[model samples]
Each structure stands twice: as structure tokens, then as C-alpha cells.
Target: MTDTDVLVVGGGPVGLGAAVEARRAGLEVVVVEPRAGTIDKACGEGLMPGALRLLQGWDVDPPGRPIAGIRYCSGETAVSHRFVGPAGRGVRRTALHEALRRRAAELGVVTVTGRVDDVEVLTSRGTVRAAGVEARWLLACDGLHSTVRRRLGLDVDPDRPAAADARRGTDDRRRYGLRHHVGVAPWTDLVEVHWTPTAEVYVTPVADDVVGIAVLGPRGTDLDAAVAASPALARRVADAPVVSTTRGAGPLRQRSHRRAAGPVRLVGDASGYVDALTGEGLRVGWAQARAAVATLDDPEAYERAWRAATRDYRVLTAGLVRWATSPARPLVVPVARRAPRVFAGVVERLAR
Candidate 1:
């Protein structure tokens, strides 16, 4: 089989990031993804300032509208924060994926379409037989419920059955996300997060005449119902035509026992995920992508970097999710209204 220095499984944004970074590092890279063309997902569609910078650094510029800040609203009470630095972009997920894919291609990263199977990690190198080739190092960016992570046995406790853990982790409150695009001129240059008792709906302007609305809530949560619950959001989209079909994803959480095992390294949602409440997944995923490639020779260092890169996302998301589901859920808007500075600080910090 043909060999390469780095083999990336999954060709979403983070996977493309890893491939691009590896190619820039003067290493031969090959990416195996089952899908072709632009990829789309149920996401907020708002790239934070930091994430935009990372994309710019990679020389992958996707077309979209600029978002200057974030606004949190519930009924009449509202809190907002304007990022002090460069504004972020609200590009469609397909646009972002295509941009990365093009950049990787320009950088000489080979793309092969197929599922990765039979991963074998040896003392000298890790090899995966896929796409009619083999590679020395494997970067698993396959996403939450990564096949590579499972094949490498990095997803569960050795003594406990995975089936049991998955069953035990099941809860009635498991969250999910749904997104749809509507044709309407955005009223604000801010990413608006409209919160309700049971869900949070994010409105991001990805084009001058198009805005994407993504609803995040527990299982069985209805997107239309969630939008109806928010008077402001419902009013805004009442007359707008939906430009895209509704898309969905989640239980919204995935856990990995480790970041690296032998010659394999996990990045992006494949690594581990808390929740999407804070809109920090792409930013954190970008950071992990850089770290995974940079520390390929030292898995320990990659683990440390992974922890450092995700520290804020994990802590803040968990705290907010806990509060969102707690008895005080109804108090969120009031708290933000009363503690404007506190709310703004948190928003601005994560907006990067």
C-alpha cells in the first residue's frame, strides 16, 4: 500500500485543519473521508473571532457576513458583548468545509474516499489500512462517536463494557441540536442567542439576506416549538422563507478516555465534547487540531495541550449547562440582566 507521513480520518473542518497543518509542517499527508464535496452540519454557523483568526492563518477564507458581537436575550431582558478585536464571520458550514478542503488540496494533501478500518499501532509507527493506502501516524478527526477511537479502544474503560456505560449514561435530558436557514436580512451584526425555558435558539447571519437558526435542547425538543416559545425570534422569522432544509445532531455530548493511544491521536469532536451551549466547539476544535499535529512525536504533550486547549470550554460549558437545566433555569435572563458586566465578560471571553 502507498504510505504517507500523516493519515487523517474524516475530512470535516478539523480534519482538514490537521491535514493542512501537517502539510505546512513539511510532512506528507493523506486524508480519507467517506463523503465528498461540501459538508454540512447542524451548527450555530457563527465562527468566533479566534476561530476566524485560525482559519485566516491557514489561508482558508470562506465568504460570509461579519459578526461583531454576541447578544443574549430572553423576553425583554437582554445582555450583549462586542468583541474588542476583529469581528468573527458567520459562514455556512458547507462554505467553511469547502474552503478548508480546497486549501488542503492546494497544499498537496491527498484526499481518498473510504471508511478507515483495521488500525494497527506498532512500536515504530501506527498504520491504518484505508482508501487503498497505509500511513505512519493516524489523526482521528472522525467526530463524536469516532470509529477510529472505538477501533483503537480509546472510548471506554477496559474493565467496563461500553454498552453498559452507554446505557448508564442515558438520561431523559439528553440534548440535541437542529438548524435551518431562512432568507431574511439580519437586523443586527451580532450573533443572537435567544434563550427560553427549555431551549436556546441561535440566530446567525451567514449572508446579507440569509440567517441560520439553530435550536439546542433536550431530546424530543421541537425546533418550531422552541422558536414559537421565543416571541422575538418567532416574529423575526415569521415571514422569512426557509432557505435550507432542517438538519440535526446530538445527544450533544461525547467522552473519550484519552486523546492519544500509541500512534493514534484524536482531535475535534472525536477527542471529547461537553456541550454546544457556549458556541466554542469550532474554536476549541481548531486549537486541538494544531496541538495534535504539533505533538505527534509526543503523545503526552498532545494530551497536555488538549487539556489546556479545552480547559475553558469544558468548565464554562458544563457550568452553564448545569445552570440551564437546574431549578434556577428560569432565572437565567434575570441574572444576565442584573449582572450585565458578568454576563458580558463571559460572553466576550468565549467569543474569542
Candidate 2:
């Protein structure tokens, strides 16, 4: 009588992740996405060590891409650290979408390539009905602007949605996402963070002979502007050649706040969001998927797990964003550069 046991709305990283885990847990999952091509959401694509291990729980091994550790450079100091077990993996957004979509197929999650016109939460036992498809369970996994979050009134407000919950600041200081691929090799074994007066650029060695840069800057500044401002990164890529296009995720007032309402649940950027500063967005999504599947037996329990896995990261990420954006380069640069042990310690704790 229904299309599937669980209807996952959206085909982004989180949605695919939810679908994958749901099917693996024996739930008949259906993913509804409106887009025609690969759903490449705006992101700085890097899976953290915690996320990579979580993938193994779902029988997903990260594609064989090498990620050394972390290299951080701010105003006065620069530090690089070698990675521990399964440091992490970096894949482009488009490539990750495609690979996950393919994996979803292997997992037997039904893919519906269309948008939902409407949804009705049937009152009987508090079931979720979307576009006449009755799902024993429902997942928002849609994204920050999740329609499910809105429909269920689980978001902060009727008109505001998730706009009022996250930390905000003066518009004069803005943050934008910028990504560019370079045609160079082995910039080093560590992921690099180059900080200028106005912005911070993260360098990821994702592919065989290429490195990806995701820089966050002010509203008027972009990837091109970041490149111009940072002679260090520019010279490193001078011979490497620029490959990926510049991209940005417009700063929004709120992130998703609803993890579940009745049988409905949210994941990744859908339930809430992570600032690009953490480079842990994908891991957050994957971790939520694991939690969601475990909680599927009872959506309420799932929400608990989701919140537990994310609460610290969300708070930690908020503080990190402030630090990354702060003008205290002298104090920040030295810590980020010379003493990666502190950062590594923080990361190890987060992974656990």
C-alpha cells in the first residue's frame, strides 16, 4: 500500500547516507529527490577520521584516497601533524554524490527521481504520509531548508523555520564557501590551512594528482579573492593550474533544528548544520545515519542518538568558527601551526 518502509526526502549526502543505512537495517527505503543529475550540494568535501570509521559500519570503505593529517598556517605560525589510523578521505562533492548514489543502488534503496507535491502525517498511530506514499517511518534528510522540518512544525517557528536557532554575528563580517581544484601533486601529506588577514583556505589532497581548496571569506570576497590575497597558496598552485570552480553556500540565519517529529527524522545538514570550519559535515551526516538506523526501531530513540552524536560537535564547531573568523591571528596562528597536538587531542576526543 506504500512505496516503501521509510521515505527519505533528498538525495544529498545525508539523505543517501540515511537511505543506505536504512536498507542495510532491512527497511525498505525510498529516496525522493527532484534533481535530474547528481545532487552536488554546496560543501567543502572532506570526511573526518570518525566518519571514515562510521562508514565501515555500513560496509562502505572510503575510496582509496590519501589524507595525511592537518597542516595549519595562520599569521605567524605553521604546524603540520601526521595522521593516526584511517586519518580521513577527501572526495569532490559531485564524485561523492555519484558514488553514494551508486552504493544506494547496491543497497536496494528505491530511488524516486521527483519532488513531493505534498505530505500528510496520517493521524493513525502518528504515521507519515508524503505524496500519498505511506512510509512506516519518515526522514527529513532533505537539508537545512527541509520541507519535512517545516511540515512537521518541528523547526523553530512557523515563518522562521530554523533561522533563529544558530549563532549569528555582524553582517560586516561574513563567511562564504569557496572551492578550487589544483593540478599539482603532494603539496604534502597533511591537509593545509592557510589563513590570511581576511579569510582561511583549507587545502585537501583528495585525488591522485590534485588538491582541493575550500576557502571561507567575507561577503565581497570569494575564492578568486582568496587566491589573490594569499601569495603562499597562489605560488603553490602557480604550476599546478586551477581546476575546480568557485562555489559558495550563502550564509543563512538558521540551520535545521528538527531531528524527528513522531515517525519523521532528520540527518546531516538536514537536521542541523556544521560550519565548513570543521570539515566534518560529511562525517556528521554519516554519523547521524548510523544513529538514525539504530533508532529506526523507535524514532524517538533515534532522535536521542542523533542529538548526542551532534550536540558536542555543533557546540565545538560554533566555537571553532569564532576562532577561525576571529582577528586574533597572532594568538591563533601559533596554536594552529606549532602545537597541532592540542588540535589533534581535540579531534581524538571528538572521534571517540
Candidate 3:
């Protein structure tokens, strides 16, 4: 069996980032992923300023359009808040994946094209084994609905009555996301979030000539219908050619009882995810990756760090998701419009 100091499951952006962090810490890392090429996902594709800074620190800068701020719109009401620090970037998922993959490669991280069906944690020996590879620590970055988490008995059932109450009813109604790209010039520098009664459409400028549209709502949301609900958004992309096949991800809410079990630590979405309502997935995942690698030797410390790192995201995103799915959903835009400073404050907090 191959040997390494750390083994990362899944080769998505967060998995690659975890591998990079381990390599930076002078540890040999191996990443196992079933997918063979650059990985893409159904995401909003807007990296907040904090996330951009983290990638820049790793010298992995992917090309994309600059995102100046965020705009919330519903009917005729609209409100926006520009980031005060470095501008965020709206990058294609594949582009971001390639950049992180390159960085991990440069650091001598090995990638295996396979899946880890079984993981064995040797607590006494301080090692973990999975898929013919042995490592001192195993990082489960496999993402929401992670098999690693489930196998380790860390998965929490959000549908349970107790769990539902703990989540503030965010899981009462499951939501999913669908993303696609269109070959149309972006009309705005800001990421525009158009609110609908049943769903929300995110418009992000990934390239000068391409815009990404993502819809989040109950399962089986029609991407076309969601965009059509927003007249202004519908008109902008009415004649544009669709550039990418639709990618989907779902049951947006996932939970893990804890971040660590024996020698394995769940990083990124594998740990737990509330929702993507605030567009904080990448930023929060990156943070968890860093924390996971930093506290590899101390599972308890890693658990604390993971909780601290995700607290804000868990709180804000869950609260927003609850509000968005509630009966007062239509008031979202108007409330933001009326309370401009409050909206700006929230945006600024998230941007950081």
C-alpha cells in the first residue's frame, strides 16, 4: 500500500485546497477522487473577497471577471452593497479546480483516480487506511452527502424532529441548486440575486462574454422558469446561447454530528452545510480546509476549530434560508431596500 502523511478524499476545490495545506505544512499528501479531469459543480461561482485572498495566498489565481458587490432584487425594489476591500471574483468551477490542482501538483501531492469505499482508522497506531493507501491522517473533503462521514457514523439526520428544531426549521423544506452558463455579455459588475416567491436566481459574471445563472429552490426547480419569473433577468439572456450543460446539486442542507472521528476529520461540506443562500460555500470550505490541516494531530482541536470556522456561516446562511423559505419571503428585497445600511453591513461581514 502507498504511504503518506495525509490522504484527502475527493478532489474538488476544497479537497485540493486541503491537500495543498498539508503539503505546505511539510506533510506528504495523496488525494483520491473518482473523477479524472477538472471537476465542476453547481455553484454560484462568486468567490468573496476573503476567499479570493486565500487563493491568492496559495498562488492559485484563476482568470475571471471582477465582482464589485452584491445586489438583491425583487419586483421593482433593489439594493446593493459594494465590497470595501479587495474585489471578489466570479470564476468558473472548472477554472478554479484547475488552478488548485496545479498548486497541489507543484507541491508534490499525488492524486489517485479511484474512490475510497472503506476507511479504517487505527487510533492506537495513529494512522488511517483507505483504498490501498495509508496515512497518518485522513481528511474527508468528499462534500455534502459524503460517504466518508456516513461510514464514520458522523452523519446527522436533519429530518429528525430534534435535528429539525436545532436547525431552526431550515431543513423542513429541502432545496436544490441548478447552474448553467450562457454566452451573453454581463450587464452588471455586481452579482445580482433575483428573488422569486418559490426560488432565487443568481446571476454572476464569470467571463466578459459569459454569465452564469444558478437557481435555488425546492427539488425539481425549472431553471428556465425560475429565470423567467424575473422579467429583467429573462430579457437579458433571452437571445443568448447556452454555453454549458446544466449541473445540479441538492438537498442543500446536510449535517454531521461532529467533524472528527478517530483519525479522520471531515473538512468542507463533508463536515456539514446549512445552505448556500448567502453564497459562502467556497469561502467557508476553504477556511475549514485550512483548519483541518492545521489541527490534524489533535482531533479535538480540529473539531473546535471547525466549529469556530463555520459558526458564522452556519448562523447567517441558515437564518437567511429559513427566512427565504418562509411565508415572509416576498419581503426580503423590500426589507433590504428599506434598511440599506443593515444590508450593507451584512454584505460587508460576508465579504470578509
- Top lDDT hit: 3
Q: How does model 2 score by TM-score?
A: 0.88
TM-score of each: 0.93, 0.88, 0.97
Candidate 2: regions farther than 4 A off: 62-64, 157-174, 338-340, 350-352
Clashes of 3: 0
Tens digits of lDDT, candidate 3, 1-352: 3399899999999999999988998999999999999988899999999999999988899999999999999977899999988899999999999999999999999999998888888767778999889888899999888989988889987555445555665444378999999999999999999998899999999999999999999987999999999998999999999999999997878888888887799988888888888999988898999998888878899988988898888888878887887889999999999999999999998999
At residue 212, candidate 2 shows an lDDT of 81
lDDT of 1 by residue, 162-241 (tens): 46335755332367899999999999999998989899999999998999999999888898899999998899999999
Query: Could you tell me the C-alpha RMSD of candidate 2 in Å?
Result: 3.2
Q: After superposing candidate 3, which stretches have Cα over 4 Å from the reference?
A: 161-173
Q: How many clashing residue pairs, candidate 1?
A: 0
CA lDDT for candidate 2:
0.71
Tens-place lDDT digits, model 2, residues 3-117: 6888988888778888988888888988888886686555656666777777666666646366657767764367766666666777777877777788899989888787766
Best by TM-score: 3
- The ten-residue window of minimal lDDT in model 3 covers 164-173
